[model samples]
Target: MAEKLESIELALFERLIDVGKLLERRADRATREHTGIKYTQYEVLIRLRNAGGEIRMTELANKLVSTPSALTYQVSQLEKAALVERVVAPGDDRGVLARITPAGRQLLREVSQAQNDMIRDAAVAPLDREQVEAAYAALGALQRHLRGEETGGILPDQAPPEDTH
Candidate 1:
């Protein structure tokens, strides 16, 4: 009985990861089709926009769960495309901030409807209201626990403070 229970728990964990990857794959394909940019880049634009169109580089990395080097590469690409710009953080000579450009905002606006439709079809349409709510609650709890209460908040735009250590 213990072995059976363990198997069930393992399956749940695996399925959660699988579903997340599957969704990312689908979103990536759709984002590329609509914007000529990878979903990863698009996500950076989204995060910057959510954070009032600018955020510290370190904080953005934390929000994306990405390495600074990887984000630097992405930001460089976006900068070349004129979709984002790197600016010196106010009052901090050593700190940089990533800000979404008007073009980035326009791109997001242009693709907004398609992205919404794709998400609704792929993630929401199949689930009933009750299932959606239950999943949201469960995932919220899991995200908070995994990300820590200090880092994860009720809204995605609520960024944690930069790590000083």
Candidate 2:
């Protein structure tokens, strides 16, 4: 006789989709509050900040997973805000090196802190330490995988245990 699956397991796919949407929603809400910058812009800014110096337009585009034209547009906006600036690359007159300005650093710091605070507060809510740690670990790993990194690989049995009792 086939055992009937519980409601939770029966709706596994739906639950996965719901969780994904909820995560995105939370991220969107937080980013909007910190700055009007979208996640894409934030990512570009973060990359420049991480570089600790200027980056060529092509490289920035690659890091942002965007095209040259799109990167140019975002860079233009950031330039207007004095968040980023462009300069000539040494030995390459045609190359434009984009760098984050002091004001941009300040803005990034503020936004980063706010995002962190939000996550820290949430970690203290509803979920226990183990759940929070697992979530954080999973998110980081997934992010890396999506970026085309060489992953350590996930196993079928290593998935989060479903509540069935």
Candidate 3:
């Protein structure tokens, strides 16, 4: 009985990872077909726009689950494309911020419908309403735990508290 339960748990975890990768690949392809930018760059632009058009580089990196160097490279590429710009954060001369350009916002606007359609077709269409709700609730719980917020999750827009040490 214990072995059966363990196998079920393992299967669930593996399936979740597999589905996430599969969906990401599909989304990447759809995004690239609709826009010239790669999905990673598109995501950077989207994150910038969602964060009121600008956010500190470190914060952005954390939000992206990416490294600072990786984000710097992406921001540089976006800079060349005129999609995003890096600027000194106000009141913090040492801090850098990533700001979306007008072009970035325009690109997002143009691709919104296509992105939505892709999500609906690839993700939502396969599942019934109840299954969707259950998955959402389960994933939400997992996400909170992973983010170290099972007790009380920090809002995505809020900055994490600074470490005293």
Candidate 4:
């Protein structure tokens, strides 16, 4: 007798979601313990740093997967903590950009170093270097596919449309 078929799609997606939640929880706890900032705030600061310390609120909110209102609240919290400030965009007084202060950079450096230290102290050995590199390449390709980049028609099950609605 064969085993009865079930919801394989649900199983796969649920497993992936569960793993993501676990990873996020661990990161949040670790970052909060060492940097006094939640993972989301740390991610915001890191993105700002990568953007050369200034980015429009709309762009930041999109990257954060948050709404403008919610992002404003977060920015206000950061501003109150003296870690970030709003500045007028050059040539556009109406446009506001978030700029990390000198103090914010110092804090980001401290927080990043601490996180790196924690990761290193985990004592986990890297997988095969060649395999890891290949995996990264594959992931980049997969990310492109997932992000709606395709040359030919993709199967519905292979690539679901992104929900921007």
For each candidate, what TM-score against the reference? 0.87, 0.62, 0.85, 0.71
Model 2 scores what on Cα lDDT? 0.71
Question: To one decimal, what is the Cα RMSD in angstroms of model 1 from the true structure?
Answer: 5.3
Per-candidate alpha-carbon RMSD to the true structure: 5.3, 11.6, 6.4, 10.2
Q: Write the per-residue lDDT of candidate 1 for residues 6-117, one digit (tens) a residue.
A: 8888999999999999999999999999999999999998888777788899999988999999999999999999999998988999999998888887898799898888
Residues 1-165, model 3: lDDT tens digits: 455568889999899999989988998999999997888898897777667778899988987889999999999999999989888987999999888888887898799889889989998999999998887788879878887533212332353422121
Give me candidate 4's TM-score against the actual structure. 0.71
CA-lDDT, candidates in order = 0.84, 0.71, 0.81, 0.70
Q: After superposition, how far is residue 75 of candidate 2 from its true place, in Å?
A: 0.8
The ten-residue window of minimal lDDT in model 4 covers 156-165
lDDT (0-100) at residue 48 of candidate 3?
76
Candidate 3, lDDT over the whole model: 0.81
Off by over 4 Å in 2: 1-25, 120-165
Query: What clash count goes with each model?
Result: 0, 0, 0, 0
User: In terms of TM-score, which candidate is stronger, 3 or 4?
Assistant: 3
Ranking by lDDT: 1, 3, 2, 4
Which window of 10 residues has the lowest lDDT sum in candidate 3?
Answer: 156-165
lDDT of 4: 0.70
- Index of the highest-TM-score prediction: 1
